[model samples]
Target: MPTIVRASVALLALGLVVAPDALALSKRDQAAVEALNQQMQAAEARYRDAMVKIANADPAGNADVDGALEDMEDVMAACAKQKGCSPTTMLTAYKRLLKQNADAAAGEETPDDGADDGASLAADVPEAARAAALLSADGQRFVKMVQYNPAVQAGIRRWLTDMRGPLIDTYENYQYMRQLMWPQFERAGLPEALLFGVMAKESNGKVHATSRAGAAGPLQFMYATGRRFGIGPDATGFDTRYDPRSSAQAAAEYFNERLGQLNQSIELSLAAYNGGEGRAQRVYNSTGGRNFWDESVYNQFPAETRDYVPMVIAAAWLFLHPKEYGLTFPKVDAKPALLRLSRPSSIYELTICMGNGGTRDGYMRALRNLNPRYQAESWLPAGTTLSATTRMVGLYNRWCLQGQRAELASTLVRSNASSAIVRTGPVTPLPAEDAEIEGGGVGAAGAVTTSPSVSKAKSKPAKPTSYTVQRGETLTAIARKFQCDTGDLAKANKLKAPRFAIRPGQKLKLTGCEG
Candidate 1:
């Protein structure tokens, strides 16, 4: 009875669309409105059941979602034309359904067993910040609508061909951090494949990858943007943008908001992700929300974004159907485990002691990725716990807990290059070519003598006029290393203020730096 009363009120409120006298339905029209409402209710129930199946990864879920959504849409359209039915009432019911789904999804996001504390990142995520089920009607529609044009096909080609190695690497890396990262997206009802696609394209799954524009983390959130989404520097001076879990959560929140604005268009939302949201919104508005693939809409975006949307889609598609393209992603044993350090050790030291354990490279990358707060070289105290895999924990116990290999690893890491070289007498110059030879013998004084350039001129080697940026190096770090004024160094390289953004291997003028 309350539902009927609400429908009557909606019809009365929507009188602007019809004559006020026509607000009251005749007996036959009343029957039609009630029938439409029943159809909508049945569709909503089916959608809820399908969402549960989807969360559990059931194949039948997709078909159920499609059918339910079609039913709802059909009812809504019929309601719009029905004399006594109100489209506004139908729209309100649809919104209520989405809100219910969102709330349910958010409630189901309990902390994983491996979480360090009860107040885990998943637990901390606000309900409103999470999205409705990706397998729900709207999300399924977006998935069904994604186009595989030539641009996307080209992206697939690149991923399967030249970028194949990177794609494989991304999958491997994502596996190790999947527990920490994927849950964030999952809780938001985002597709896991989309997360991988973005991570693959953005950073090759490198957690600390920072772009020239100062975007950081696996999701590559720019600093300002990261701040808006509750991801910034913590009190410990660690930027959460470099954190896989937090960054993934922030990225999900970003896409959730963008998709809401872009009428659930994945291409447009992705374009917003890469290009500025303001630019994406303007284009959407000017085109009256046309399809993103439309020439008029597609051409308006920058070259980078135009490439980015399809590439992401292609990567996601490959993620969904890797075997279809004859690509087999390596299987990884990613069961979460914790490693409590038996003694103080660096990640580099752990890597040496951990050995290959059947992996091509050791656990160095995994260690860095899982425990992003600490650098590879930064020593952790004894009993310090680290997020690790079962395999890594097993390796640590076998090889790293105060055994011969553990001692050897510790010695190797502690052995300094400077300490290895001993000077006992005045340096004697040698031929440049000879100086470059490896393993030159110690001098008569039982110390290694300088092989090159005891340059008698001693005019201080000419200050380098230019420098190539190195990985993980920031402008401030470079300034400190080169003893240059930060402002002057930025100006010399024409870098912008605040961010002083620079990418690895970017060339910069060393004009303001000293020898």
Candidate 2:
């Protein structure tokens, strides 16, 4: 008799009353209890798997949460059909056992605001509809502040519906650049889950994202708000708001400041983060220390701010407890590395050649996140190095070298929409034979009429498909030595004739050559 789960944020927000009669079960009924226990255990395992993705802020994690929720719903439906057992009764029974275990550990550890372990927090909280400040044994922390309310339940339901896809996208984006941003929140003694929640909603983890209201960055800082937290533009014209590390640091400090003025309430702090701190402060001061979700205080904020507060909390809640929602986050191989380009290329070209076979999503977003200094289409010189994942480095070596995929990627990136259309201006076609040699240019016959610098070379019978030019060598000499048309060689290298100066290390295509 496994129970169904999926309600996620809603599950935490929804309240229930356990049936008093199920408390006393005879020995003969133990078999039914055992079967139900097994089902609950399986659902929890799936929940744990989904939480890892939320921990990493990966978007695909929601799928598992969705599955778990559906399973839980099924269980609940079945629970209704059970004669003596009910979903509420079973959940309460499980919760009570967990609390007993936590109470036993109370002698050794406190539950909240004092380095609470995950096991203790999970056990102590009623779980059906309660809030707690949770800290893992290893020091990771998250505040489950939006627990057990109709409004919050509505928010969770919304997350399960429309926000599902964006949640995954945001998480995936955040995970790729977590190295650049997570440490900021950690240093500020803030919950990384809060960071992910804010970032997911504000910018979907896109560093360059900006709102119509002039908010920018992963945290969506406004110009004035960013400056207050030591984040703005630098001398080099790079906006610090667009820097994930700087923006996250600023956001952490900003949240801490808001917490101080807003009675240390995460809900109030978040309301201010979305609305204005001044407006939120006024509401708080006028309401005489009223809680953020208090009808009086909640009604004072704008409609958008009211919605924003619960959504942020729900997202943060999901980040901390994706398993409860049945979401399993996908693990990403984000080991860092430096990738040097083998040839002149752009991020656009690299992204195409470096496939997403290793990751759930393509590395394009990851690439852009890690290397924000250049635009995707910016052409980088050969040997230019970029911050990249180990997977990308391996892919670059295998597929982005001088290969078909590499060439195709380059071609794809270079293809211009305007170039695809016919040119409007009159065109000059090549002459059939040698034409007037103007300005020491190459004649149509592949001869230089002036500029003796391109002196003809000694003849040779051998021929090759390509040649690397030596120092002080001229295009005329190489063409003559190969017994090929010089103009064709000039066209191959996109160089003019006459003073066809060739430099050392220059590779020439011997097109139209003859032995």
Candidate 3:
């Protein structure tokens, strides 16, 4: 009622345009607009219910109720006038009202009605103390919204396409690893679903994934955390986190420890994983030791952690019901099988070894897609046998028959010759062990012993440079500055704009520009 009319008028002005020159909308467009308007009406009804609840609960806050109602009217007016505003916009407005009401209620002191103390926080509490009281309720609601949000579901669909077979293969690998680690999860009484969520978030199911944070494997367990759970680097230079089976076990154990300390709440355990256990513990203690969704808990952590629980729940929901959510998961021609290579090889080397048969290019793409943690483009390194489907194995066998391993090894030697020579220097010849490990045991055709010094002398390379674009600078201007065409610049940087309207701090590639 308060300022609702003024807000509605303003929104209508911004959203609707009735002009003589305006083109008539098609029947389909009109129908779509009507649908959006109906969604707005539904959203408004829900918002009004929330406002009524707020007014009834807080006797002294007619002002908050008035503001909420006004905002709702404005949002509805905007939707009606535009006829193109999505359900997302309407829903967002409703949620904003609910959040504001919740925040206000959390800040005041009110008598409890013998409801679960974990359901909400006491009013009149300080900002820091309020999060613990409200986090549980907020967390539950957040998870629900994420599970149902159509836009979020659409995003997951896009991600599935980009990830395709590699993610599926990795998920299958996770099942195998989970089997070996189930005992640990069972012993800890931790939810099995938590592992899947963690794996998806950390590495998109890639067993060999590593993070910049030094968290390794599917769970992204750091060295300290891994050590705490009895998983770490071994004598063979294998970090247990890189091994699917070992990492799964360690993740289960670590999660159990957090759950034990945090009242068996998965939300709190997750917060500890993203932020830190000590911070979570401090927050829990500050919020009267309630569950993670207590309003008091939200007030304690950073914004990233506030959103993390919802994201995790969203991912879990998608994984459980990909088809229901309209996600087109990749179809596998056949179930993937793990192959143990007798010799160590890099992913690059393995690609060459698996040569041009039965979709070898597809196999390499899948390997890169699955193992994003591998920074190097090629070579899986020696002693590391990779898991791939039958198709990949057939390709690898074909490449082996062609006798191209030596050729590939020669290319690698030539490529890395400069770095190898520079690092080893003249007096200290390349170590035999290092050579064998890096060279992947060069073939009998002088592949292994190709002189690094000789190769370095023959290869010629150019240096890289940077370029800056000024105000009103076109792609043509920037390209000309670097002595290259506009098309080359666009291609190199993947610019989609017809003409470059470069903004400050926008980097343009000039590394390969010709004079």
Candidate 4:
């Protein structure tokens, strides 16, 4: 069921509605009240059937759902005016629907990482006019914000099917950063769901995620665009675009600006966000403020944007109504806290010292996202403070402060690969094996030929231009292994100092290094 029906049904079932004095009313009014209650029940039945069909992707379901809701509202309105109607009597019927929602939610399979899965739709009104106002003013306004077209339906289908993992990850990551990000949108009078949609589509809530086109951060603001919104690089050369609070604030301002210019069209504003404001504004002006869905407007934006707008809307729709689709979002214990280093430590060390604590990945990503300025391998000095969740801080105290695991983590992070290899005096070689062997030949006696080249031809092994970092490796270690200056390696990799932080699997240029 849609949000309206579910919330209304829940509030009604929870006994928010009050009963009228039946004995004081005439017998005719009693009969009218009873009839209205029966109508409400029938409408509710139809609403349930329509919800099922809607869940199954039936086109007729939307109309039927709306019709049933209207019918129920009409009955409730009439009963509010009727002398002896008891709103409590509607509870028994709706309680079943409420239980169904709970059961459905419980039945859905949660992913191993975590697939996890709010507002009263209606108010109990003793007065008829108040009841009508409550229904019109409060419960339905949220539902009216966006259009759920076929494009949105397709987007929803994709999210529920192939894109489900991304949706879950976005939800999980957003929860960790919600305190930092959501307040910006909330203060701007924007919907929380819209914020989720944009972040979900843009970066799946990865704080340091950068697009190939040069957009950076959780909200994916380009360098120039971010500067306009007070989210450019700081004096220290750290881009605030990667900061959740800064980026979300910029995003809120951006959407408000676009919405104002685009006649309050969310699709248009979203188009501007993805396709560039210049194109979106130009299309808006040329179309004479036509709806974004109009062919003249829709066709003007690039295909990426055309897909983006709908996907964003669909995500927002699901955000508001997850139970309706049987989708669950995992719960995160993300209570924010500050962690002052008890000793100098890197995030890699901290991650190793602090166990997973039931999370699939350790707290590494969360630490990186929350404390973007520091690289995962960058050593944070004693007394340096970092943003963290309460759970993480607790874990740090329990497992990372001064234990054997903590020492092991520190030792691991400090390890150097170059120290492990030793050089010995050159020795006699054996006969070479088959010449057809790849990567040079081995000897038949298992001792390889020591010649630099075949037939006295002097040649050198080509140096590699790039290298992929391996796990538990560092920039200094890599530089040592390749017999290159650490400073030169960092410069080639464009790594920032003093952190010069690098993650495993990140590619680096091997300029000035022997490979």
Which candidate comes out best when scored by TM-score? 4
Task: List, residue by residue over 1-515, the lDDT tens digit for candidate 1.
Answer: 12212222222223213221257678998898889889988988887787566666666765776677667767765765788786556656556654565465467664344322212222322321222323232233234647878989999999999999999999999999999987777555467878988999999998989999999999999999999999999976689999999999999889878876776678999999999999999999999999899999999999999999999998888988888999999888889999998777778889999999998777888899998887776646667889999999999989998789999997776554443443443576554554544554554224435644543345445777878899998766676556566557777788853346789999988776763
Model 4 over residues 314-423: C-alpha lDDT tens digits?
Answer: 88888888999999888788999999988877788899999897786678888989999888766566788999999999999998988799889877876667757753
TM-score result, candidate 2: 0.57
Residue 20 of model 2 has an lDDT of: 27
What is the per-residue lDDT of model 3 for residues 1-515, given as tens digits with 9 covering 90 to 100?
Answer: 11332233223322222212235677776676677656556656654564455445544333443555565555555454453454344545544543554575666554364322212321212321222222221222223322245434544554467645554654544544444544444333344455665666677666667777788876788889788887787764446776666776777667656755665466787889888889999998788777666677866889878666655655655566668757654444444565555443445656656654433234554554344334333223234556566666666565643465746743552243223334322333455554545445446323344356644544444534666667766665465445554545676777643323457677777755752
lDDT of 4 at 458: 42
Residue-level lDDT tens digits of model 2 in 1-515: 01121143223212131232455677655566566656766766675566455345556655765675555545544454444555555455335434544554555444343332233334434432232132111123355443447776777777778988888788888887889888776544466778887887788888888889999877899999999899888875567888888888898788867765664577888888988999989999999978987889988888999888778777777777788898776788878899998776677788899877567668888887777666665556677888888888999999999789988996676554543554333334435354555564444345434323324443444657789999866665576566655556777788742235568998888888763
TM-score, per-candidate, Cα-based = 0.61, 0.57, 0.43, 0.61
lDDT of each: 0.75, 0.67, 0.53, 0.75
Candidate 4 TM-score versus the reference: 0.61
Instruction: Count clashes in each candidate, considering only residues at least 3 apart in sequence or on different chains.
Output: 0, 20, 36, 4
- Span of ten consecutive residues with least summed lDDT in model 2: 1-10
Model 3 alpha-carbon miss at residue 329, Å: 1.7
Q: In candidate 4, which residue pairs clash?
A: 116-328, 116-329, 116-330, 117-329
Which is better, 1 or 2, measured by TM-score? Answer: 1
Q: Candidate order by TM-score, highest to lowest?
A: 4, 1, 2, 3
